[model samples]
Target: MVRELFNSIAKRYDLVNRLTTLGLDKRWRRKACEIALTYVDVKKPRILDVACGTGDMIMCMRKRLERRGIPAKFYGLDCSERMLEIAKKKVPFAELKVGNAEEILFPDGSFDLVSVAFGLRNFSDREKAIGEIHRVLKRRGILLILEFSRSESLLGKLTWFYTRSVVPIIGGILTGNREAYNHLWRSIETFPSPEELSMEFEKRGFKVLTMEWFFPRIAFVMVLEKV
Candidate 1:
C-alpha cells in the first residue's frame, strides 16, 4: 500500500519534503550525517543512505563533508523507482539502487556509515531492516536515524499538531496529493517511540549515543554505533 502510494507520489516527494519541513529537513539531514561522520574516519569512507527517497539526505551529507574538503563513497538506496529517478537527476554522481531495506544485497560490513532518514517506519518488518542495516555496517560503524518523535513539551505538542494537521494540508495544497501526505502523517504517528527504536538498535548490537529532539516531539536525530 505504502509502496504504491510512494511510487505514485514520487514525482512530488522532494518538493513536499522541502516545503512541509519549512526547509528545516535539510538541517535535520545534516545533523544525521554529522552523527554518522563522528563515528567514522573519512579520508574517503564508504557510506550508504538507506531509504534515500529523493536523495536529499545524501545531498545534505555530501555538502556536510564537502565543506570540510573530505571525500566519501556514497550510495543511496530506495524501493521507489520514481524517487530514485528524481534523486539521480539531482545527484548525478550518487550510486542509487532500488532494493528492499530489510533484504539488501550488500555484503556484510560494506559501509562504514549507514543513515536512514524518514524510511524505517515504512518497513513492514522493521526488525528485519534493522538487522540488514547492522549486517551492512562495518565493525563500530555508525548508524544515524532521523525520524518523527512524540513530543512531551507544550510547545512541542503544538508543533506536533502542525505536523499532523497543517503540514499535510500544506502538502496537499502544494503537491496536489493530500492522501499521500495523509499517509505520511499516519505512518509517523504509528511509528515506534524513540525509546523503543533505541532498544531495537541495542538489540541489533548498536550502542546508543544521543538523540536530538526537534520541535515536533517525534522528530529526532538518533546516533548509534555497532558494538
Candidate 2:
C-alpha cells in the first residue's frame, strides 16, 4: 500500500513536500547533513541513506561533503522503484537499491554512516530495521534520523492542526492522493515521542549523541552511535 502510494505520487512528491513544508524541509535536511558531517572523520566515508526519497538527503550531504573535499561514497535504498527512479536523476552518483529497511541487503559493517529522513515511521518493523542498521554500520558508526514527533507547545498545536487538516487537502489537490497524506499525518500522530525513540536506540546498543528538535518541537534530528 505504501509503495504503491509513493509510486503514484513520485512525479509530484518533491513538489508536494516543498509546498506542504513551505520549503523548510530543505533547510531541515541541510541542517541534518551539517550535523552528520561533523562525525565524519574518515577520508572516504561510506554513507547509506535508507528510504531515500527523491535523493534530496543524499544529494545535500554529497554537495556539502564535496565542498569540504571529503569524497564520500553514497548509497540509497527505497522500496518504491518509482521513487528510486526520481532519486537517481537527482543523485546520479549514488548507488541505489530497492529493498526493505527491516531486511537490508548489504553486508554487515558496510557503511560508516546511515541516515533516514521521515522514513522510519513507515517501516513495517522499526526494531528489526534498527537491528539491521546496527548490523550494517561499522562499529561506533553514526545513525542520523530526521523525523516528526508529537509536540504540545502552542506552535506545535498549530502545526499539528495544519498537518491534520490542511496537509491532506493540499496533498490531495497536488498529488490526487488524499489518503496518502492522511497516512502521513496518522504516522506522525502515532510515532514515538523523541525521548521514547531515544530509549529504543539505547535498548539496542546505540548511544544517543544528540537529540535536537526543530522549532516547535514537531520534528527532531537524532544522532546515535552504534555501540
lDDT of each: 0.83, 0.93
Q: How large is the C-alpha RMSD of every model relative to the true structure?
A: 1.5, 0.7
lDDT of 2 at 154: 86
TM-score of each: 0.94, 0.98
Q: Candidate 2 residues 6-105, lDDT tens each? A: 9999999999999989988998999988997798789999999999989999999999998998898999999999999999898999999999899999
lDDT, model 1, position 129: 91
Candidate 1 overall Cα lDDT vs. reference? 0.83
Q: How high is the lDDT of residue 210 in model 2? A: 85
Tell me model 2's lDDT, rounded to 2 decimals: 0.93
Candidate 1 per-residue lDDT, tens place, 1-227, comes to 76777888788777777787777887777767777677677588788999988888888888888988889888999988888888999888899999989898899999888998888888888888999999999898888898886667887778878888887798788767788878777887777788888988898789998888865455788889888
Give the TM-score (vs. native) of candidate 1: 0.94
User: Least accurate stretch of 10 residues (summed lDDT) in model 1?
Assistant: 210-219
Least well predicted 10-residue stretch by lDDT in candidate 2: 210-219
Model 1 pairs in collision: 148-218, 149-217, 149-218, 149-219, 150-218, 151-217
